[model samples]
Target chain A: MPPAASPVPCKPLFFDLALNHIGFPSLDHKLPVKGAEAASPASAGEANKPDQPGGLSGLVKGLWGWGSKK
Target chain B: MAHNIKNVRIQAAYAELKKLIDQGSYSRIIKTTNKIVNDDQSQPEAWQCKVVAYIQLDQFKEAINAINKAPNRQQMQFELAYSQYRLNKVAAAIDTLDSAPDKDSPRGKELRAQILYRLEQHSECYTVYRELLRTTADDMDMERTTNMAAVQVHRVELGQCPVPS
Candidate 1:
């Protein structure tokens, strides 16, 4: 009698580490409003003050003034 | 609003699916993805997740079916070919790959090389592996090098020169 044929061993195939490669979609979420931090009480008070500029300009002015004083 | 509620439901479903995937829960992923797709048949991500889960479970036919229903089938050509390859439909896999827009991608090339190796086209397989090695980073060279060595071994077994001239 003839012997039964055995199955061949298949080599391992390399796959991407992440599901993103398989077309899995990312979570869709809304971005926070820009300058939302300015709404904080401390920052709002600082912004409302007559002399202080708001946000980036305020930070830059503070830095420049500090440098000039030195 | 109704729109907000729907968005929240979809978000929660996706979050659960992500958690299931991280846990390697293939069955749960299939169940969850099925529910998601039932609620919204146009959810390409749900179809994609179901296909991947089916493949992981060695259910290639089911994977292929899920892929057929996906809205973004064109973008999932590699995955379709992969499932076909797992099913031992090598020629079909190759045909599917030939139609892929990103056939030149590293993953696509790697899969093509594997199918060529299975078909015993060693020289073609070697050329693909060489191309991959040339582009692969040093840290990721181990697997490609191993595959290249296997090709050389097969060549030697066939009484040909181990290394290509």
Candidate 2:
């Protein structure tokens, strides 16, 4: 017999802003098609890191128009 | 009759708005629909079109307000939930979708499952997708497979299921 199904959690999981209507995660970055070769590696590396802002300072930075640093 | 003429005019305006939307003219969609609504607020289709334009322009608050005032709120509940979901109003989105008139609508179910996944309600989300597999037989294999994987991961995370040996 198949394994018993797991129970539903009382609360929901963390949210993902990049998910589309179909339950698939959308690629947040623009694809490198036309100007990919011209792109710098530094920016590409930054794209891979998660978007967690650490604390109050990070939240302030986010609110005050500070972007991700190199 | 004057009413028939007004209906024809509204249809023409809506057709023009639809063309603008297809051309990706979201701003013009708003402008044109604004005129249409000013003339006829009873046209629910115009309200719906304006809501769609606002969403495309990333104006979630405006979209939410528009949906709230829509005459056919039940018909447009999915769009309302979608805007709420985009705004990170997860619980509200779920609630809105729960009240959708078409309870078994595949699109509504699919979006609800996605929101459930975001909330980490993986087991419940997976169950929804599984039910959808039977109701929706087209272009859903990837959705099902990914949701299954998500549920398995969630189960392991919760220690309800062991990791593969």
TM-score of each: 0.69, 0.63
For model 2, the superposed segments whose C-alpha errors exceed 4 Å read A1-70, B1-11
lDDT of 2 at B84: 86
lDDT of 1 by residue, B39-119 (tens): 778887788788888877889898898888889788788889888887789999899999999899877888888888777
> Each model's DockQ?
0.11, 0.02
Question: lDDT tens string, model 1, A1-70?
Answer: 9899999856544433212345445533311222465677888887777665558877787899899999
Candidate whose lDDT is highest: 1
lDDT of 2: 0.70
Instruction: Chain A only: give the TM-score of model 2.
Output: 0.23
DockQ of structure 2: 0.02
